[model samples]
Target: MGAMAAAYGPLLPYLMRRFAIGVSVAGLVFGVHFAGGLLGVTASMLSLGRLTSRVAVSGALGLMAIGCIGVALALSWLVMLAGVFLIGIGFGALDLRINQMLAYSVNPKRVALLNGLNGVFGIGAVAAPILVSIAGARYGLIYAGGAAVAAVALLGFRGVPGRLRGASSSGTAPSSRRTARLVVIFATAFGLYVGVEIGVAGWMPTHLHSAGFGLAAAATLTSGFWLALAAGRFLVAPLTLRVSDSAIVLGGTAVAVLCLAGALIAPFAPVAYIATGLAIAPVFPTGVAWLATLNPANPGATSWLFPASMVGGALIPSAIGLVIARVGAGWVPTILAAVAIGTLAAFAAAARS
Candidate 1:
């Protein structure tokens, strides 16, 4: 999932060259891909009772492999989009099911495990840009490799059980009105966070290139950004033992805002963006654990978060693209800083709710 998603960072230039498209058209890649993600999450939610994890996870992997092949062989821009949408579907469904299963598990170490899981995602994300750089115009090779990886991952799921038992909790369900409020607030927060994350990952390379950095250096810096994110997740797992999840999230977001602000300087851009990754690493998983703690009765509390994230992933990056079209890519970090502020506000609202 990380490799497939992060490939867009370095792949954007090749895509524009191949399709003879501008930033605006290139922006649709993230939109169409994440639109499919929303559908996948919705489908998985709807199929909870009907489909088993073994079936759902396996089917998703199958779709991912098929989608990657579709992308690799696409002859036209539209066909490539169709392929990306398919990949999004598989990515969304797989992401939701895994997170849902972990959220409902009885394991006491689930929060740390969630961080570890996403850390692995960071690993793949860290590798993708380097691979894309090496592949160059043969960008299709990256997608083909993603397909191969998905195919191999299928074998590992054979032992996964069909049904997951929801962990037992003693908290009473909140009033409907309060519950709805919490949902809206957290949804907004998740949406904003995801938007910021994807927006940075998708646009930072281009931003750096526009700022006069070489493409290869930009790609390496992008990988470094993901490396920081991956490392932060592993480093923060132990902190969960002593720090409150809410505090961790608040502190992380605050620091991320500062890092993004610092990124506005050309000389500090790479370092600042990489620092931003570390700052925001704990927000998503820790937010999940925090939400679960707040609303224990609903094992599906985190379900809303998945679709919200997909919405963020879809809308924010495209929105950034639009901004780039109008102003220029150098403003990328400024735009992201503004989005991070919105994210901070949303999380604050969630805290009150």
Candidate 2:
């Protein structure tokens, strides 16, 4: 899922060339993809009451496999969009279900485990560009490969159980109020954090290219950002033995804000962006774990977070694009810094209350 999701950006130029389309038409890929993701998340949330984990997870994987096949066979750009939309649905549902399952699990090592799981996603994300480079104009092979993996992964879910131990629970009014507040704060925090993460990733290459770096160099630095994220997710799991999840999120976001601030300097921009990814790597998984702990009575507490993240992924970067059009690409780091600051503030508020 992560590989296919991340593949889109690196694969965009090929997509455009393959269909003989301009940037204006090609850009709709993101919108179509994310729109499918939002609907997928909603569908997953709605299915909480009716669907088993095995059924939901399996079905999502099936959709992803079919979507990839669709993209692999598509001859037109619109068909490719449709394929990506299908992939987004599967991606969104599988993402939510897996995290939800892990967060609500009873394992003592679950925090580290969750971080590790998300780190694997980072690994997939980091691998995507390389895969794109290898596949070149035949990028459909990458999607076809992803489809094979997704299909094979279905066998792993046979023992996931129809329901989890803590999958469902009831809450009282006071706890409900607290849960609602935490949800809003964390959801907002996640939205902003995802926005910043995706924003930096989506714009940094362009920003660096505009600043005079060669296209290849800019792309390499962008890959560094993803590598840092993957590395951080793996490395931070050890810290969970000594530190609390909330503290980790707070510290990570704070450092990310500082890193983005440093990125405003042209020479330091690449290092700063990479550092920002490293700092924020553990925030998403750690925050989800922390929220589950806080609202143990409601297993569905983390469901809303998925939608918030999707919205942020779509909205924040688009907002940054508007500012970039008016001003320039140089403001990319500045805008990301502002978003990181907002993320830090949101996490801080959540931590306090």
Candidate 3:
């Protein structure tokens, strides 16, 4: 779902051209998806009481498969936006459920386990560009393939016994002023995280292309960005056991800020993008770990996190689009730098939690 959420980036240039839209409208494409995603996440929170995790996961996957095919064959702006919206819902629900499974594990699913799951997500993100680069001209193939995978996964999910399947918490919920504060802090940080992370993934191809790189070159740079993201997850997973998770997050965001600074200067180069991804990788898992560790009774609390991140996904990219529309692509770094600062703010607030 993370991969599908971000897979639209390299295709943005094409989607803009194919649909008769501008940069600002291009960003709105993601906004609608996040809107639906927010709804879906909210629904999952409610549905937890009524459904098995396997049923919820399966339903989400089916929705995603249909949504992908819808986007792949869309003929109008309304249709495309609808497809994106459905995709958002499915992605949001499935991921929220997955996080519930991981975060609330008896083993607690921390350190290496958490990193492995996260690294696979990064790899999925990496695969998006490669799929796009291979058949970008006929981009529906990517969506079609995604739909197929979702279908297969949907089938595989049925094998799980109801016993091992995911379950919703029926315990008395934790609703305190401090809990609210922690939720706000974590949600804020996650929003910024998605803003920069998905924002960069969504726009990097166009960013490079605007800076005079060819289509293929831009796609490769985009792939490199995701590759670095995967690398960071795999490499940092082990180190989390040694260094404190909070330190990793703080240092990670700080380095990410510097990398964005580098990107501001070398706007066209892939190296800066790669470094930015590498620096950005550890923040999410560690933040979630920290959040879940502190608030176990509300382990499902982060059921809203993916949706919150999707909000960031929508607004941040849209803000960048506004900049690209009103000012110029050169000014994009300013927005990115501001986002990095926002990320730092999240880290500071998260530490307090």
Candidate 4:
């Protein structure tokens, strides 16, 4: 879903021309996508008692497959908006549900495993845009390919319900005031983490173009970001076993801040963007791990992160666009630097709270 929705970043300019939409409208489109996601995750959590995990996962994946094909083939602006919104719902639901499941099963060693799984998203982020680039047509066969993959995945959906059932028996979430306070604090951190991550991915191409880079070069840099992100998740996994989650998150965010500083100040932007990806890779997965520690058993404990993240993804990039319009895209790095710092500070506050 990250890839499917984010592929639009590099393609946004072309999409703007094809769909005859302005940057503000385009930003609104992106916002709508996240809003759909917020709805999907919320509905999933609220209806958990009525809907089996198997049915929910299957339906969500199916929607994703359909949505991707729809977006790729959409002929009008409204159709594209619908497709994007559908993709958002699918992405949001699966992301929240799957991660919630992982949180339910958390242990020291398992935290590393969770990071590794998230790394896989980086791989998809890299590939999805490239597939669009490779197809080269306004509407291409690659979108349908996503649907086919989802169809095949449905065969394996049967086991999810069993796992969810097992999760219910193994742990107990906190009900105290401490848990409520921690949840509120961590939700803020999670939102910022998601905002920075999605904002960078969604707007990098546009920012690079403003800095005078060509389309191909910009797309390559964007892919490099995801590549580094995917690589970092695995490379850092071994360290998670030894390092405290707080230290790892702090270290990662601090290095990410430095990378954003480089991106802001450097003559060339790709190097900094790539380094930023690698440095910031640990934040989300480590956050998931940390959040589980606060309230290990309740999936809803972690559900709040999804809504927070969705709101962040929706608002921050749009805010960046509005700022870029006033200040120029050269300020992209500076803007991102502040966001990176904010994330670092948010995590520190969460640690204390």
Candidate 1 weakest ten by summed lDDT: 166-175
What's every prediction's RMSD, in angstroms? 2.6, 2.4, 2.2, 2.5
What is the total number of backbone clashes in candidate 2? 0
Q: What's the C-alpha lDDT at position 286 in model 2?
A: 95
Model 3, which residues run further than 4 Å from truth? Answer: 160-174
In angstroms, the error of model 2 at 190 is 0.8
Tell me which residue pairs clash in candidate 3.
none
lDDT per residue (tens digit) for residues 1-353 in model 1? 99888888678888899999987898899999899999998888766656789999999999999999999999899999999999999999999888777766778888888888889999999999998888888988888988999999999999877655642333222337877678778889999999989988999999999988988889889999899998999999999988888888988998999999998899899999999999999899888878877776575566778889999999999999998899999889999999999999989878776
Instruction: Put the candidates in lDDT order, highest first.
Output: 1, 2, 3, 4
Best by TM-score: 1
In the range 284-351, model 2's lDDT, one tens digit per residue, is 99999999888764667788888888788777776666677678889989899999999999999998
Identify the runs in model 4 with alpha carbons over 4 angstroms from their true place. Answer: 106-108, 137-140, 163-174
Candidate 2, pairs of clashing residues: none
Candidate 4: 10-residue stretch with minimal lDDT: 165-174
Q: Encode model 4's per-residue lDDT on 187-225: one tens digit a residue.
A: 788787777887777788877877778876787789888
Cα error, candidate 2, residue 346 (Å): 0.8
Better of 3 and 4 by lDDT: 3
